[model samples]
Target chain A: MPSATMLPITDVSACCTNVTRETISAENAELLARSLKALADPARLRLISIVAASEGAEACVCDLTEPLGLSQPTVSHHLKVLVDAGYLEREKRGTWAYYRLTPGSLDAVSSLLATV
Target chain B: MPSATMLPITDVSACCTNVTRETISAENAELLARSLKALADPARLRLISIVAASEGAEACVCDLTEPLGLSQPTVSHHLKVLVDAGYLEREKRGTWAYYRLTPGSLDAVSSLLATV
Candidate 1:
């Protein structure tokens, strides 16, 4: 397993001026695709919408579970997938887990779709 | 299995404000996800990039195969997938098939990714 405290190096080169400014490389495409895949599911889409429309652009596991009409674990599972893909960041406060949309994640995707 | 000359109906109501202005539905999300899935591959990414950089933002099957480092049949297959997904429109000119990025396809996707 990878070390717990070490930040990922792959992420450093994986930001802006990438998929937008330059022709997206295959490697970058895969990464971006994986991120997009997180939003690929309808359940995930509603999750994003529910959270996005929430105050402060954030939501917790408790608020999310009921609206999605799925089991808690399933909701958590999807949230984890979103977080793993870098779309959402997770913050654990006591018994609750707060999920917030990361800045620039959606914009990068937006820029990629922008026609010249 | 379906007859030709009768264009697809799915393309309608599948456009603007679908992924952007409205909260994406499960069915629509699936459709868009499948479309995005077609672009999820690296070869397809390169193919799109190459085509975008081409004059008139279009390319033939011949211009794509070599750069993609894939067999002709494989390249053709990817183009078909793009066409089927509504991302690229196909026109068979003589013995060659010319593929052009469909209007508003990229922009609708861009709009969806746009935050606020």
Candidate 2:
């Protein structure tokens, strides 16, 4: 069953069979690749981790710049890619933009790699 | 708990907390990123999936070229990256090389992305 935290995934299959269970279709492979590509960078992963681990599982653009030790623009760029990839959710709050983990997004991709 | 299928991961933390649970260190993020980078390609994911689904959870370079719709050299290159990343294992089989999922390698990574 799909977890309650799982959001609607447009490009990839939901609860799709993983690599261990059966051969994945090419289309599904492409979608999965796109999602994984967004997470392929160390900077992006750090950004995600920071936001995910932040209080309320969310963080503001202002707060992320310091711990990430990256330029504001660079952090924003990574966040944008993550949002576009559907792994994150972005919201505007006053002068800053807040990003949050998109519920089951990471879990969905993780499950795809399951070998058991 | 780490599954029996999970293999030993040298670079990253074992049963380490994910981003959802806490902020990840840069070093861990880099290691995770490297692992994810290896799986960020459609061809690679397809390759992994195909190998995992094959009988005995293994495949030869010869059998992979056709379904992947890529040249032998291309397939071989991707396989090498996966092996280096520790997701797949390569073994000599007389005339050809057989590749198989490295037991817990994929699951260890999948567990890393767990949000719950």
- What is candidate 2's lDDT per residue for B42-109, written digit by digit as tens? 89999988897798888999999999899999999999888888788899989999999887888788
Fnat for model 2 comes to 0.88
Encode model 1's per-residue lDDT on B1-114: one tens digit a residue.
112321222352344243434566655555556656666676776777677777777889999998778999999888877677666788888998888877766666666667
Best by DockQ: 2
What is the docking quality class of candidate 2?
Answer: medium
Tens digits of per-residue lDDT for model 2, A9-116: 433646456766778888777777777888888888888888877888889988989988999999888888888888888889888788988878877777777665
* RMSD per model, one decimal: 4.6, 5.7
In the order shown, the candidates' DockQ scores are 0.48, 0.69
| Most accurate candidate by lDDT | 2
Candidate 2, pairs of clashing residues: B5-B104, B6-B104, B7-B104
Worst 10 residues of 2 chain B by lDDT: B1-10
Name the regions of candidate 1 deviating beyond 4 angstroms. Answer: A1-23, B1-23
